[model samples]
Target chain A: MINVENLTKTFGAKRAVDGISFSVERGEVLGFLGPNGAGKSTTMRMITGFLPPSGGRISVGGHDVVDQPIAVKRLIGYLPENAPAYTDMTVNGFLSFSAEIRGLRGDAKKKAVSRAVEMCFLERVLHQSVETLSKGYRHRTCFAQSILHDPDVLILDEPTDGLDPNQKHEVRQLIRRMGEKKAIIFSTHILEEVDAVCSRAIIIDRGRIVANGTPLELRRKSEYAGAITLSVRGVSASAVTQKLSQLSSAKRTSVIAENGSKVTVTVFPKPNMDGELTRAVIDATQVWQVEELRTEEGRMDEVFRSITMPDTAKSPESRVQSPQS
Target chain B: MNSWANIKTIAKRELVAYFASPLAYVFIVIFLLLCGFFTFSVKPNLFDRGQASLSGTFFFWHPWFYMFLVPAVGMRLWAEERRVGTLELLLTMPITAWQAIVGKFLASWLFLGLALALTFPVVWTVNYLGTPDNGVIFASYIGSWLMAGAYLAISCMTSAMTRTQVVSFIISVVVCLFLILAGFQPVVDFISGFAGPKVVDFVTSFSVVTHFEGFQKGVLDSRDVLFFLSVIAFSLFTTGVILRSHRAG
Candidate 1:
């Protein structure tokens, strides 16, 4: 439902979004993962027609964002980063106004507002002034306004930013449910959120997409699969290391730490031998009490850091030669 | 049909917002009190004028009065949206820029008209005492409404330039002051000597007071009506350009 080609947004001397191209299909949820100032919100703004892109083209539901802005905007619902709302307006009043701007009126306007209120769980505070509500409620109110028109595409920037744990869970559930019927591109720094709600993930860093894949696919490519940590008792450290190295699958093994009779070993497996090496370690250390032996599953934080921050030790040419995919 | 719905929605919200706060009441009260005070205390005896026309007292100060009052009303039209960040939401709607602009202008203009209508007591008093020129009174009301629209357009443009209400108000007042002073006798005298009489007359013809004076005399010249309409149209068009640039930038 949305296509962005070579999109770049520049703010004076600074390039906020640089040559990013991605498309989202209907009923697909794409999580935009990035750190602060990573051009996520800028991309969202350009797609929503709130800010013009310095270069490239964006189209929503086949309408060019620049040439056919009114049509494109009609098909998309955008919740800006900060959830800026009219503080003086009541909750129902704001939603009703939004519905009207979307061309709904009379019974249609009323039904749209009522549906938005129910979806965002805003019925309880429908009559309260928005300025008087808590941040979570205010955020929900913004969500209500954006979807009031039932647009085909939803561009939400940090939709669950300030909510408490329970509120976050509720909002995430709502997002997941909405994603089943609409095209969604939600930007967030929360990695676990991507795991929870997004079917596909696009990781952006320093104004560029560094990685794009499913969560399981990303985990498979991570370096965490190469290493294993083991805790053992009743075996001499040198003997355990030697036995571990003797296995054809084991690339290297060394004792990380030793205290009393317990030993912690860090093991690196040879290529194409992750599971084999773990099994060999368990078999070789049968004489010792195996307290813990498992391959480390990399945390999303590590994947984020590794992608964003290239290892300085690697020469520039070598890094450039290495294929990302 | 969609455009009409969009305009109605925006107008309704704007008018409701005006009434929800103390803004509408405050503006009306201050407007009525100031106009009444100037009409009775500041002017020389109304009886001595003997013309039974408000041209000397009530209608004379409208240009200056509106120079400040209209800005006070229009300064928040777009500036508040920027300050609160609702401009993005407004722009993201399906409505076009012209729809939003015209919708807001109409709402604020209607509010100003209501405020002007509250001064009927002044008209009633004048009619009760002497043989007032009903034609002049009618024309004066029309003039005041047109002038209010002109001032409102200028204020809307200024408000679009800045997010701060104070800055919007100050800038609008300054611009409106220039437009009002362009036609005064002293300014015209100063300019006539340097630039030729034709240039002075052209500049004077563009002033708010210059066109409004004809209405005070109960003479609805087509030129005067066209001048006010042109000013309103020009200012609103400029406002549209500025807002479009803002959205693009």
Candidate 2:
């Protein structure tokens, strides 16, 4: 339902979004992941027709964004960064105005407002002015406005931003549910949200896309993916490394810890291989009294950090700059 | 009609925005008080003039009064939206930029019209005192509203140029001041002393006061009406250009 090809936005001498190409179809939720100021909001603005791209084409629901902004906009419901709304208006008034502007009126407008109010959990504050609401309620009020018309496409920039955990979860669920029928693209800083709600995710850095794949595929790119960890009693670190190295599927082995007679080590698998490494590690560790053994599913946090900050991730000096270290 | 609906929705919201705060009532009361004070208390007071018409004492003060007051109402039109980050939401709506501009302009112009209309008591006073040229008074009202609209459109343009309301207000007042001062009696005389008749007419032609004076005399000249409307159209067009440039950047 949405197609963008070589989208670029330049502000003066700086390029805000450079050569971004992606398409989203119905029933797909594309999670946009990047660090702060990575052009996530700028890209969304271009797609929503708020900011015209300096180059390339964007078409939503078969209408070109620049050539036919109103038609494209009619099909899209966008929630901009910061979730801004009319602070002076009541929640109901804001929603009703949104509905009216979307061309819904009378009973249809009423139903749309009531339905969005229910969806956003804005019932308690319906009569309250937007200025008096908490950050979460204010965010939801702006969100409710976007969905009032039930457009075919929804462009949400940092939808979960400034929400509590429960509200975040609810919004994620809402996005996931609505995504079954509408093409949705939402940018988020939270890595877990990418895994939780996105069918596919794109990681942008400095106005460029660095990674684009399914959540599972992206996670599998982590350094520790499919690696086996073994902790055994009555064995030396060197003995465990030597034993694991003999296995044909093991690419390399590293000793993680050694205390008294207990040794902990991990076996890295060869590229493009699978469970064969796990079985071989199991057989090699069977000679000792095994305390614990498990295969690691690659972590999202590690992948996110490695992909975004590759220079400082693995060097000896990394510890000095690494927050985790 | 469809585009009209979009304009109305925008206008309605703007009107609601005005009345939703204390600013609207405060502005109206202040406008009425100023009109009353200038007309009844200052020299050439309505009673002393011995004229039933408000054209000289009451309507004469409108252009000067609107200079500051109209901008105050209009400064927030675009500046507030930009400040609150609602400009993104507003521009991304399905409506065209012109619709939003017209809607916001009409709403504020209507507001100024309402404030001007509340001075009907002055009309009552003139009517009760003696027979007056009601036609001239009505034309003055129309001229006053159109002049307010021209001022409001300038304010709208200035507002679109900045995110700060105070800056918008100040710039709008300055621009409106120049427009009023051009045909202002003293300024016209000052220019006429050195520039001669041709130059003087050229400068005064741009002044809203010069055109508005004819409306006060019940002279429904198309040129004057066109002058005010052209000012509105040009300013609003400039507003759209400013907003578009900002968005493009």
Candidate 3:
């Protein structure tokens, strides 16, 4: 439903979004992950036809964004960064105004507003002025406006930024459910949200796409991926590390924890030998007591920190973002 | 028809937004009180002079009143949207910048018209005092509204330049002041002494004062009407350019 090619936006001397290209199809929820000032909002703005690109092209539902902005805008339902709405208006009035602008009138407008109100749980505050509502209700009111038109494409910038955990979960579920039919793209600082809702996630740093993959695929980029963790008693920490390093399939081993007699150690598998390391470890630790042994599934924050935080990185390999993997 | 619908929807929203706050009531009360005070209590009192027509009494103070009041009414049009971060939402809507601009301008223009209409009791007073020329009073009201429209349009342009309403208000007042000063009676007379008739005509042509004079005198000259309409069109067009440049940045 959406296509962007070499999309770039420059604000005078600074390049906010640099040569970013990605396509979103129906039934896909693309999670945009980046630290602050990484141009997530800028990219979303360009996609929704709010900010014209300095270079490249963007089209929504077969209409060029710059050439046919109205057509593109018609297909998009956008919730901006702060979820701003008319503070002077009541929740119902604001939604009706949004519906009216989207060309929903009379009966159609009423149905749309009610449906959105129900979905966003805005029924309790229907007649209440937005200025009197709390932050969550205000945010929900803006969210309702976006979906009132039932647009085919949804571009939300930080939709769950200021919500409580329950509200965040509800919004994420709504996005996931809506993603089945609409091309949904949302940016957030929460990594778990990417796991919870996104079919695929793209991590960008300093206005560049550092990694792009499914949640599991991206987590595989972590150093602990495919490594085997062993918790055993009757074994010294040094002995576990020393014995695990001698195995042919193990590249190295680190003692994760050293209790009195119990030591938890993890073995790094050699390249292309993750399958053999488990069996190799089992045979090597036959004489020792193996209480718990499992392969690490890796972590999202580890991959995120490794890819985004370059200054503190101890290993150069984690810096590379292999989107195909 | 679809385009008109969009414009109407936007205009209605803007009009409702005005009444949703105390600003509208305050502005109307203040505007009416000022007009009444100046007409009855200030120098050249309406009843003391015993004038039958409202040209010098009721209509004369409109331009000066609108110079400051119109900007205050319009300063929030775009500035508030920008401050609330709704400018992004508004510009990204399916409507064109032209429609949004025209819709918002019409809403505020209609609002100024309403404020002007609230002074109809003044019209009744003039009619009650003596046999007044109702035709001239009607034309003067039309002229007053058009002049207010011109000032309101300039305010829209200034409002688009910044998110601060105070800054928009100050700049709009300054620009509208220049429009009045260009053809101000004293400035025109002073220029006529040093410059030729054509040069003086050229300078006064840009001022609302010169154009509004014809309507105030009960003459609906097409040229005068055209002057006010052109100011509205030109300012609205400039406002569109300013808004487009904002998104382009």
Best by DockQ: 2
Q: Give the alpha carbon lDDT tens digit for every residue of B162-205 in model 2.
A: 99999999999999999999999999989988998999999999
lDDT of 3 by residue, B1-249 (tens): 999999999999999999999999999999999999988888788987888888777777888898899999999999999999988888888999889999999999999999999998998998898988899999999999999999999999999999999999999999999889888889988999989999988888888888888998999999988888888999999998898888787
The two-chain DockQ for each candidate, comma-separated, is 0.77, 0.91, 0.83
Candidate 2 runs further than 4 Å off: A245-248, A251-262, A315-325
lDDT score at residue A230, model 2, on the 0-100 scale: 79
Given candidate 2, what's the lDDT at residue A241? 74
Question: Where does model 2 sit among the CAPRI classes?
Answer: high
Question: How would you encode candidate 1's per-residue C-alpha lDDT over A1-325 as one tens digit per residue?
Answer: 9999999888778888889999999999999987799999889988988888999999999999999999999899999998988888999888878887777879998999999899888989999999899999999999998888888899999999999999999989988899999999998878899889998889888778888887766655555556677888888877767777778886666667788999887676776688887778777778879899878664566677667776733222223221111
* Candidate 2 local lDDT, residue A250: 75
Quality of candidate 3's docking, in CAPRI categories? high
Q: In model 2, which residue pairs have backbone atoms overlapping below 3 Å?
A: none
**lDDT (tens digit, per residue) of candidate 3 on A1-325:** 8998998999888999899999999999999998899989999999888889999999999999999999999999999999999898999999999998898888999999999999999989999999999999999999999999999999999999899999999999999999999999999999889899999999988888999999989988877778898999997777777788888888777766778888887787877688899899999999998899999877788888879996674344333322212
* 2 or 3, greater by lDDT: 2
Angstrom error of the Cα, residue B70, model 2: value is 0.7
Alpha carbon lDDT of residue A129, candidate 3?
97
Question: What local lDDT does model 2 show for residue B182?
Answer: 93
TM-score (all chains, Cα) for each model: 0.93, 0.96, 0.96
| Between candidates 1 and 3, the lDDT winner | 3
Model 1 ranges off by over 4 Å: A235-260, A265-273, A311-325
